[model samples]
Target: MPNILNLQSLLGLAVIVGACWAVSENRRAFPWKLAIGAVLVQAALVLLVFGVPGSAVVLNAITGAVDGLATATRRGTQFIFGYLAGGEQPYVVQNQPALFVFAFEVLPLILVISALSALLWHWKILKWITRGFGLLFQRTMGLGGASALAVAANIFLGMIESPIVIRAYLDKLTRSEVFLMMVVGLATVAGSTMVAYATILGPVLPNAAGHVLVASIVSAPAGILLARIIIPETPGEGGAHADYDSDLKYDSAIDAIVKGTADGLMVVLNISAVLIVFVALVALVNVMLGGFWLFDGPVTVERVLGWLFAPVAWLIGVEWSEAGRAGWLLGVKLTLTEFVAFIELGNIPAGEMSERTRMLMTYAVCGFANIGSVGITVTGLSVLMPERRQMVLDMVWKALFAGFLATLMSAAVVGALPGAVFGT
Candidate 1:
């Protein structure tokens, strides 16, 4: 592992905040109180989940629960698809790793999780949880009810789907509030994707489910902090109270399952299509660049990305020695998608990177902030409120920057904490 007391990460925290300050729209109107509060709230959440007594037990239980759900998902997949989905095969396999196929085994988990999530939403279990967090955000961060609710829902519903909850208030939200929602949306992953990520990283990191979930939760406040810095709120610019009525309604439990399954199908197909195309494109580019060689390696896409983002990796407390690979993952995440980057991270040989670096990279790339997502978010919001399309376009690029930095900020916090906090 890297240094238990990573002092450099403390500097990183300052640098990240300074970078956000440098991009402030209203430098004079800096949200000093919000900045301090957001960071404090994030730290308190981390301590409550990891550092406090009995926290590890709870986290372990979450991990076990996630693993159990994955197992349950496999049973469904296997029953449906037979040996292709990791059921007993008639023929013996020589290679153990090759037995588990991503499309057949991993992607199906999204479908199961999505249906379950929809059911939970219909049952009001997820809503109350979202409301609790929303209220917390409203109280601590001084966010309006609509903005707070949107950010809280973004943790579970994802960027594109999150706006649906606030669709009624989109026109009412101020420019700053919309941008905050966008930044937070981009900075976090959805509940449906959480299990898939955990399954992918399971071999590489222990308690992978807990780590994935914590990364999303931890980054929420970081998103708030950076969004406020980039576009500080003007006085009397937002609705003080939100109705909290959801536009996402279901006729019944079965209706929710059917609708959620349809949504999950689209998600699974999109992911499958994107991965197929993106991975092939990367390979094609690598083949084209295969002849060129840098000082120690070939000038491939990963190497190029590593060169571009190595400094960011270092800033997040990865050692200089492992920063190149870490940077490559970050770049892949930004350019391609987090799914592609995570698959690459899982592909890396064990023991080549330190546990600290692996953990930091996991948190660093745990956001939906990527090139593809920018289009999805802008287009989705535009569809939700056609009148606000221009405004959405105007601030989206900046929100992307803030959102990406938000995830990095979470990694920085992780780095600054003691190694024992993660049981390392």
Candidate 2:
């Protein structure tokens, strides 16, 4: 981690931004102001949260709060899985292995967060925050009111849960708006899952919770900004609309809890299936790649994708020495899932990666932007708003690309800031 903000890094950032612009759905209508503005906002957030003393203190406080929440969440899991869930040891305190057991650990946070999100919405708290953030996004990025609300809500809600906030507006949304919704949904990870990721990476990255939280918040504006640039608003679309009042049709507190738990159950099952399938597929491909070894060693999908994305990682401030390592995570994240990428990142040995590279890569890889997410996004959103099912299918691939680019943009923005290097 060199402290210098050299010419190479500047060029890297420019190339990354240019690549994003080149892939715009309509290059002629690209929104440069929004793109630049969003990057600046993301940079400010990065500086304040990661750089400034006061802001870091506040963010640390929030991270500590989440740690407390995780502790409480662990209580429920401990009741169910006992020793496997890893709270108190059967004998004395010692190190615990990271558990991927669906029922024991990962899925419980989803269930808790889902129910908590419903309760917040039912209590009108989430509505107010969503409206406030929605208005802010609209003003900042020139997004439509409904689209702004949905994207803002996505900061704390799941892809499907967030869209449910704007369910009434889905039918009337323009193609650009629909695409924006899909991209933002795919670009950001859900809040409940953030807790799980933080729980997973907490061992390696101190402040893991804050970084994951910040990624979700900052990626919202970046996703909206990128989606607009990629697909500008059509003439006469509801780009001017800004109503934040959503029809939150929860029967009662108990009903919200029940429905949320049920939704989380279905999502847990889907996630379990996704992980099982992708892990097995990656192993199968690796086995084949292993049979055809190059002079250096056996080559696999990771090496191929890593070489492709190495420049992209370098473009976002990862040092050339560790660019491939960072890029490998990006490749894994995009091709498989962020979950797998995070697990790989967690597995990386201490000191093998510089602190700066690790932090930038964390920002880079923290998203739901993957190929498999395309199908999941379509399935989830279609069920939420069936009228847009065909439109969703049409723009699925484009949205996935937009989502990936948006996360890359987030990484780039954070990289551009002088304050992102740890221990500076």
TM-score versus the correct structure, for each prediction: 0.97, 0.92
lDDT (tens digit, per residue) of candidate 2 on 341-391: 887887787668766677677778888889888878888888987877888
lDDT of each: 0.89, 0.79
Model 2 TM-score is 0.92
The local lDDT score (0 to 100) that residue 157 gets in candidate 2 is: 80
Predicted candidate 1 versus true structure: per-residue lDDT over 1-424, tens digit per residue: 5463377776777888899999899888888898788777877787788888988788889888888888998898899889888798889888877888999777988998899899999999999999999999998888999999999999998798888988878888899999999999999999999989988988888777888888999899999999999999899788546877889889999999999988998899988988899889999999999999988888999899999999888888889888899999999999889999888888887789888898998899999999888988888998898898999999999999999999999999888888888887
Question: Which candidate number maximizes TM-score?
Answer: 1
Off by over 4 Å in 2: 1-10, 87-103, 240-242, 420-422
Candidate 1 lDDT: 0.89
Off by over 4 Å in 1: 1-5
**Any residue pairs clashing in model 1, and if so which?**
none
